[model samples]
Target: MRRSIPCLCLAAALLAPAAVQARVAQARIARMHTPVATLEQVQVRLDWAEHADSGQLRIRAGRVDAPALGYHFRDLTWTCPLRRTPEDGWQCEGALRGQGVAQRALALRGQGAAPLRLGIHFDVDALTATLAQGQARLALERRTATPDLTTLILTRVPLVWAQALLAQAWEGASFGKGTLDGRLAIVAPAAAPLRVSGPLRLHAAALQNADSSIVGEGLGGDFQLAYVGSAAARVTVAGVLHGGEFLVGSTYVALPPAPVGLHIEADSAGAEGWRLPRIEWRDGDVLAGSGRARLAPDGNVRELELQAHSGDLGPLAPRYLSGWLGVLGLSGVELRGGVDMTTRIEDGALVEVTAVVRDAGLHDPAGRFGFDGLRGDLRYSAEAPVDSQLQWTAGELYGLEFGAAAIPLRSGDGTLRSRAPWRVPMQGGSLTLSDVAIRPAREDAGADIRFGMALEGIDFGRVSKALGLPAFTGVLGGEIPSAHYANDRIDFDGGLTLHLFDGTVRFSELALERPFGTAPSLTADIALKGLDLARLTEVLGFGTITGRLDGSIEGLRLVDWTPVAFDARFASYPAPGVKQRISQRAVQDIGSVGDSSFMASLQGQLIGLFSDFGYRRLGIGCRLENQICTMSGLSGSAGAQDENAFTIVEGSGVPRLDVIGFNRAVDWTTLVQRLLAAGKGEVAPVIE
Candidate 1:
C-alpha cells in the first residue's frame, strides 16, 4: 500500500505568498531508471531552486550514484536560469560540477523547444562542446585551443551497443587530447552482439607519448567501419600521417621521412583473426603490395605476402631516415623493379625473408647501371640451425653501356662468396682463383676483399684512362691473351702489338705487383723495331730526340702508385736502313724528363768536352735505389765513343761538370716538378 502525501507539500509551496516562497526548497527529476537486474544501488538526484522575483527554477545540484558503472559522484551542482525567448520556449543557463570532473566543470547552457539544444564550456578554460538534436537527427561540435587537439562529433548513437575498433600503432599508441565524434546506427534491437555501421572523422590530431610529449604530427583520418560483433569489424581510412606508418604494427612497415599514401581493408571471417585480402600503398616512388595478411587473436600477423617497387632508390638510403636530403651527390638515377616475398616472425624478430626481383635498373647521369635479367630466390632465417643464406644468379648485367656479363653471388653464415669477380674465361684465356678467402681479420675490422682475376685482350691504356691516370702511350693493337694477377701481383706474359711513333712496336713480359699495403713494382724489357724517337718525344710533349731508342726498365718499383726506382737505359742505335739525326736540345730535354742527375751531369760534361759528337753515341746506366741514382760505366760503355776515354773535343768548360749523385734522393714532389718543367722545356741550371 502506498500513501499520497506529496501533493499537499507541492500545493503549499505553489500557493505560498511571494515573500514566503523564497524559503522553500524542492527536488525533482524529469526521468529516472533502476533496472531490476542491477545488484548495485543506483540513484540520481536533481535539485531545483526558484528565485521569487525572477520566476525562474534553477537546478542547483545533481547526484548520480551508479556503483555498477564505476560511477560514484558527489558535490554535483548546476545552475539554469530561466529566460523568455521569441519562440516562447524556455531557455536555461546551467552548469555541472562533480567530484570526478574530467574534461572540465562544464557550464552547460541550453534552450528547449521540444528537442534540446545545449552548449557547454569548461569554465574560463579553452574548450567548447555543443549538442543539438531534433527528433531522429543529432549533431555535436567541439573545439579546443591546443593546436594539435582533435575534435570528434558523433550522431545517432545507440545507448546500448557493443563495438570494437582496431588500429595499428606504428609508433606506439596513447590517448591524446583529442575529441572523438562518430555516427553509429544499430541495425536491429540491442542484443548480445549488435551490428553497427557509421562514418568516423578525426582531424588535426597529434600523437604524443604517454606523458603527453609530442612525438609525431599530422595524423587524422575519416573512415567507415562496419561491425557485426566485438570480434568482427572492418575499417577503411584515407588520411595523412607523419613519422612512420604500419599495418598491424608488424605486417606492413613504411619507414619515415618517406611519406606513403595508405589504403587497406580487412575482414575476420576467413580465419580466426583479421584476414586482409588486398592492401596497396605508394611511398615516394615506391609501390608496396600486401596480400592475404592473416592475423592471430593476439594481434600478431601470422602470414603476409608483400612486394615493393621503386623507380628511384636514392630516397631509400639510410641517410634519408634522419631527413637529410642533400647527401646523395648524383642525379638521373632511375630504378624499376619489385620484390615478391613472404615473411614470418619467430621469437619477435625478423627470422625469414624470401624474395626475388627482375629487370632492375640503377642509373646515373652518365648512363644506366643495370641488370639485364635478375632471377633469384633468397632466404634468411637467423634462428635456424644452419642459419640460412642469401643466393643470387643473374643472366646479365650492364655497366655504363660497356657490355653485359653474368653475376652470380652466394652469401651465408656471415660470408659472401662469388664465383668470379668479372667475366668467365673464354678462348685462350682461363680464369682460376686458388684458395681466395676474405673475412674479418680481427675485431673492428672493415671489409677485406681478396680475389684474383685473369684477362685476355684487356687494354692497359683503356684501363688507365678509365682509372683517371696520366696517359702513357702504349702498344694496344692486339689482345693480351694471357694475363693473370694473383696474390696482388699481376703478370702479363703475352705481347701487345701497338702502332706508335709512326712505327709498330711490341711490348712484352710486362709484370707488376701491387700488394696490399705496399707499392706496385713493374718490370718490362722494351724492344723497338723501328721506333721514331723524334715523334715519340713530340707525342710525349718534349723536344725531339732522334734515332731508334732501345731501352729496358728492370725491377721498376712504383711505391704508392709513384715511380720510385728502376734501372733504365736508352741508346741511340743507328738503324740499318735509315740515317737518323739527333738534336742537342733533344738530348737536354730527355735528360730533363728523366730527372736523372747522372744523365744531366753526363750530358753537360760530354757536350762541354766534345764538339760535333756523333752517335759516336751515348748511353747511360744508373742503379736507382733509395731514390738515389748511381751512375756506372760512364767511360766508353757499349756505344760509339770518341777517341779519348771521355772526350770528343776538349773545351775545359767547368771541368765537364760531372755531378756525382746531384739532386738525387730528393723528395718526390720536387723531383716530379723538375721532370714536368723539363718536359715543358722550362729546366733551370743546377745551382750546386
Candidate 2:
C-alpha cells in the first residue's frame, strides 16, 4: 500500500504542475489584450466581467505608453472609453495628465466630438523647452468665460522651443488690447543664438524689463525686429513709431499730443554696443535729423550727432531756444529765428558744437520795438571747461522808430565777448540829422555823436521846439553840431551866439553829467553881454524877468532821470516888447511840466517870498549842496552883477528837477508830492 501510495502522489504532482502552467498562460493573454483598471511598476491588474458589457475602461498607472503614437505618461491615472464608431475608427475619451507652474487639465475629444477633427484644450500657465522636431502641426484653443476676459488662440508652436516662441510675441501682447498676431522662428537654449524675427500687430502691448538698466518708452508704435545670437546678442530693427513720446534724463519731451512721424534703422552688438544708421522725424512744419549714437562697453555714449530745424520760428524760439535776453541779463524780450546746429557727444557730455542763427529779430514785449537783419555765428567747446566766445556783426535797420521822430540809420558792428561778465563792443554807425534837434530821442540819443561840436550855426528856436521845451524865441541861430559822451561825461566843445531883442550872448565849453555820482560833472563858462527881458518873458512864461541872464550851470546831473543842484547867477539887462503879467498859475504849470524848478520849491515853502517874483536890474548868486541852498546875495545885495538869474531853493539833499531852458516851473501839488517821495527819510536844517 505504501509503494502504491507513492506512485499515486507522483502522478498527482505531475498533473498539478501542468495545470499551473496552463493558468499562468491564460493570465498572460488577458493582460496583453485588455485594458487594466490599475498598475504599479511591472505589476498590473485587469477587471474582467463574466458577461459582455460596455467598452468603457478605467485606467490607473504608475507609468503607461502608446508606442504607436510616440507618447508616454508617468505616474498617471485616468478614466476613458474605447468604442468602435460606425465610421470604423476607434474613439477614446478620458482625463489627460497635466503638470508644472501651469495647472492644465486637457479635455480629450476625438472625431465624434471634433467634427472630423481631433481637438484638445489645456489650461496651461507656462511652457519651456530645449529642442523640438515635428512635421505634424498642432493648434490649441483656450478660453476663460468668467473671472477674466482673456482668450487665447494658438497655432503651429513647437514643444522644445515654447519659451522662445512666447517671448518673441510678448511686446505685442502688452499694448492696446494686450493682443498679438504674429509669426516667429525660435531656437531654444540658444546654443548659438535664439533667433526670433517677426512682424507683430499688437492690440494692446507693453513691456517692462526690470532687469535692464535703461527703460524703453513709446512702445505703442509699429515694430519689426530680429534678435540673433546669445541672450545679449545682435539685434536689427526697422520700423516707424507713432502716437507716443519718451524722455531721457529729466527732459520731458513729448510728441505733439497727436500723431508724429518716426523713421529708424538700428543695429546692436551683444546688448551693450549699438548704433543708429539714420533716424529722422517730421511733424507739422518741423524736421529733426539724427545720426548714430553708439554706447561704449562701459555704458557711455561713444558718439552722437543730433540736429533739428523748423521753417516757422515761433514754435521753438520762445520755448526751447530763448535767445539774446537769455544770453543777456535783460528781461521782457524774446528772439525769433531759425537755427542750424551740429553737436558731438563723447562719454555722455557735449564735447563740441557749432551753431548759427540764419535770420532773426529782436522783439520787445514792452513796445520798445525790435531789431531785425540779425544774423550771427556761435561755437562752443566743452573741452575747455568754459563757454566758447561768440562774435556778432549786423547791418541795416529792419524797422526802428522812437517817439514821433523817424531817423534813418546806416550800418553798425558789434562784438559780444563771452567771458565772465560778457561785454559788447559796438563801433560804427551813422544817422541823418533831422530838421530840428534838441535832446535826441532816447532810442536815437547817441546815433550821430562825434568828437567836437560847435554850435556856431543852429536855430535855437528849432532846437527848443523839437525838445518839447519852451521856445526861447530869441534870434539865436547857428550850427552847434557834434558832441561826445564816450568817456562818460557829455561835453559840448562848441559855442553858440545869441542875438535877440538887442542882446548878445555866448556859451563856450559846455559839459554836463546827469548825476553827481560816478558821472563827470558839467563845467560850463558863458558870457551874456546884453539880453532883452521882454523876449525872455514872452518865451519863459515868467513875470517880466528882465535880465542879462549871464551865469554858468556847474556840476549838473540828469543821471537820476530827475534833477540835481547847480550854480548860477542873474543880473540886469535892458529890453522891451515882452508880456508883463505872467500869472502864477502859468508859472506853476510850467514848473510842474518841466519838473525842475527852484521857484516851484520856494513857492510851497515861503509863499509870496517875492510878491511878483521878478528881477529887473537885479543880481544874485547861490551855491547848492547837501540839500541846502546858500544864498550869497538877493537882488543887489552883493556885488554879484550878472543879468542871468538862478534861484537855488533846496531842502533835504534830494536832487533837483531836470528841467532844461525856461520850462522849469512846476505845480505846487506835484512839487509837494515829489518832494515827499524824494525826501521820505532825508531831513535837513531849514533856512528861512
Residue-level lDDT tens digits of model 1 in 1-688: 0000111122222433432344444445433333101112212222234543323333322344432122434454433433333443223333334454322212111243332333333322232334343331223222234422223346432211101122221222333333334764433222344344566554434343333323433344455655454345554443333444323321223355544556666665434656676667656554444544665545455666665554444444331221211112233344445445665443333445555654554444333233334445455443442222222232211121234344444444434445445554322232333223333212244334445443344343554455554454553444455455554566765665655555655666777665322344666555555577767766566555556765555666666556677775555566776544434444454345344322233455445443222343444455577766544323444221323222111111332322222232345455567557766778633312
In candidate 1, which residue ranges exceed 4 Å CA deviation?
1-118, 121-222, 225-261, 264-279, 282-288, 292-305, 308-332, 337-356, 366-402, 408-457, 473-688
User: In model 2, where do residues sit more than 4 Å from their true spots?
Assistant: 1-190, 199-220, 229-232, 235-237, 243-245, 250-252, 257-259, 263-278, 295-302, 307-312, 317-338, 360-371, 376-688
lDDT score at residue 676, model 1, on the 0-100 scale = 76
Instruction: Give the per-residue lDDT digits (tens) of candidate 2, residues 280-333.
Output: 665555445556677644334567887766655554543233332332223355
Best by lDDT: 1
Hey, what RMSD does candidate 1 come out at? 14.4
Q: How many clashing pairs per prediction, in order?
A: 7, 43
Error of 1 at 600 (Å): 9.1
